[model samples]
Target: MRSAAPAPRVIAVVGPTAAGKSDLGVFLAQQLGGEVVNADSMQLYRGMDIGTAKLTLGERGGVPHHLLDIWDVTEPANVATYQQLARAEIDRLLAQGRTPVLVGGSGLYVRGAIDVLEFPGTDPEVRARLEGELEEHGPGALHARLAAADPEAARAILPGNGRRIVRALEVIEITGRPFTANLPSHESVYDTVQIGVDVGRPELDERITVRVDRMWEAGLIDEVRALEERGLREGRTASRALGYQQILDAFAGECTEGEARAETVRATKRFARRQDSWFRRDPRVHWLSGAMEDRAELPRQALALVERAVTA
Candidate 1:
């Protein structure tokens, strides 16, 4: 027999992109006899490696990572599905007395995995119709419609994010409620030690540009081409992934390759800013500098907080 109370600790490494969350997560997991449970929504898609900055097996440093590479690039992401899978993995790890190091910059995914949140039920018919409208009319049209239906949700979701726009529209159709109404205010499903890796704007911008360049150097175009054959263009969620979206646009003759690269840098910086803003809203998060000069000490500091969370 088990009590309803959850196990005492889950360490969440959250923040803007390029803030050293992944390496810090590996360090904490190694130290705590834990596995990394991915919270990044994009990393769920298979073959989205370089662009999403998904760690290579070698980079994982022998610690296991869960909830990664679990979906095909053509599959639309469902956060509710992710929540169920993540909780399963977390509970399994806890049963074995192993920590779950939840890592990534995806704010809603993090909430879905560890918060007392309820998602509005989805209807395939409504979702399919909305998605069809999105494909035909483009995100701008759907986004404008979403704005009219739920201005708050429209403000929160980017206009170019067709997949999310479709989702918002679908929820509105199915529930006849504002999309933001389903979002969590604040209740946790786990005893969490939430760490937010902070970085200065200048440094974070530079980091994002460098990372995008490295992704280009690491064969991101080739990766995209490969995935395209796997129906990546049809995959609503995966097709619109930051770098992938831009590159796919280039392939579709919407822009030049150079323009794609530049847009990727620009969009990633914007996304990072959004990620930072989202995590910053959670007062439970303990902030730590993820600057290059301070990264070496992050692991030790984060571990101390996890210990504190255990005792407190």
Candidate 2:
């Protein structure tokens, strides 16, 4: 009898913002006969298009994309929920003998989808206490406390991200262990090959500037205005997104529109650096140059890497 063929492998496209991960993901999905599952946290919110650089239907090139625009702007981000949704899509695609291309710059969401990771259960009382402290003293104060308790977790989470800080503290309280200690080792639940789009800092910075400019020109202010009407300001996660936060400040008369635009560019650059650092620490990702000169070859190189990983 003939030997059975190996199971289909999942593909993940990851990198900093403006590294061309989205287009590359579409190309891979088309080439591999797969569907795209979004991993970007911001893109999960509905009506967050231009700021998130979410792809249009035409840009998707007829390849089905999953998990995009699935949440309302008022809803808070929940990676644990995302993990469940992403895995369901991946398993559905796999069951049909098709590859599932997971793509985004959100490092934890990507890992949650494919890794053997377990999120710690939440305690309402603990969460309420931490949230109360966050409201009373601000995220920086709580972040300082977290740094004292779990330096590594504090390093991974941004100081301004109160929700994450609260979650970390809650986990520490519940488990009586460091938050980082609860993270799973580098073990995967699925056979996945992660392709990281690589671009130098200089080029990446320029790309982010241009991308932010384009977002402004494409009516990001209007998008924020629409979402604001839908309680975007009430959403903890959505309200704090890079461009949206800056624009919202402008709307509140805290800054001029031009200042908001400039700040958005700067903030996006900082976020890109953080994203690069996060993905660089992962040993399993295969890096491919996303330089403008090499753009034509990126998909081909990525496909070759996937083939090598699958066969090896």
Candidate 3:
């Protein structure tokens, strides 16, 4: 029933944390009759709700959101898998004559989903070798191995980021090419209109603090306890989230509640800075100041841009 041609358009809402990107996505979806596709990595897990700030049913307002809780904490979610699932969702949305709005702070997932990036298939043998190295030398050592083998990927991956480091090593060992070299060389998959939310540092930091406190009030700690009770530990995907990590620390008596909360806020501010840096590399993104006097105006502006993109 569908033509053998590409879809008309997709809009991606990307920005730093606490920049109201999610709110804008919801508003745009309601206004434009689009479906929200999750692009945030941590938000993909099922029980990791409060820390991820996952939208409640009321927040989504009955709009269909794809790729939000499709993966379990024990499963490994890489870019290749994400790209496949997201493309399928986008295709399905387009077939139904609806717009697809990809929204999140995870720049890597956004790029992988919309760009021509090719993530080489995972190799279990290579993964086993990397896992051995991780056991023998730890995550930092594995990162150093990646840095030596694929400096470009190393630059993007922080040393403490065991997930990425392991992935880089796994790819390099499997494909016999540097992991960074496998990225898309030219052009992207979607004819996307990129929108970035910009907020000043002080305000962003304050927002992070407030959001962390809100998560605490919303039973984020209890959620962590429940996950632990379900056997989702530190190395698991559900536990690596910023809020989850700090709350787990408190749960384990490694830190006081006050100290854990402070650390979580601080980590969140740092993560937001990293997110801004990553999205800044994309020149196509139109920056919208989060400090705008009329916060509600953002959706209208985004809608206008997307309408023009699709119509053009």
Winning candidate number (TM-score): 2
Report the C-alpha lDDT of model 1 over 187-218, residue by residue, as the tens digit.
99988889999999999999999999999999
In the range 1-312, model 3's lDDT, one tens digit per residue, is: 222233247878999888998988887777776899999998898787888989998899788899987777766667778888999998898788887989999887898888988778877777878777787888898888788888889988888878778888887878899988886643778778889998889989998999999999999878888878766674455667898878788878899988999999988999999999988877888888776465767766666766666666
Predict model 3's lDDT versus the native.
0.82
Q: What is the overall TM-score of model 2 with all chains considered together? A: 0.96
Which 10 residues in a row give candidate 2 its minimum summed lDDT?
A: 1-10
**TM-score for each candidate, following the candidate numbering:** 0.93, 0.96, 0.92
Superposed on all Cα atoms, the candidates' RMSDs to the truth, in angstroms, are 3.9, 2.9, 3.8
> Residue 252 in model 2: shift from native, Å?
0.9
Q: Return the lDDT, model 2, position 286.
A: 87
Clashes of each: 0, 0, 0
Cα lDDT listed for each candidate: 0.89, 0.92, 0.82
| Location of the lowest summed lDDT over 10 successive residues in candidate 3 | 1-10
Using alpha carbons, what is the TM-score of model 3?
Answer: 0.92
| Model 2, span 175-228: residue lDDT tens | 999999987677999988899999999999999999999999999999999999
- On the 0 to 100 scale, the lDDT of residue 201 in model 3 is 90
Q: Give the poorly placed runs of model 3, Cα more than 4 Å off.
A: 1-8, 292-294
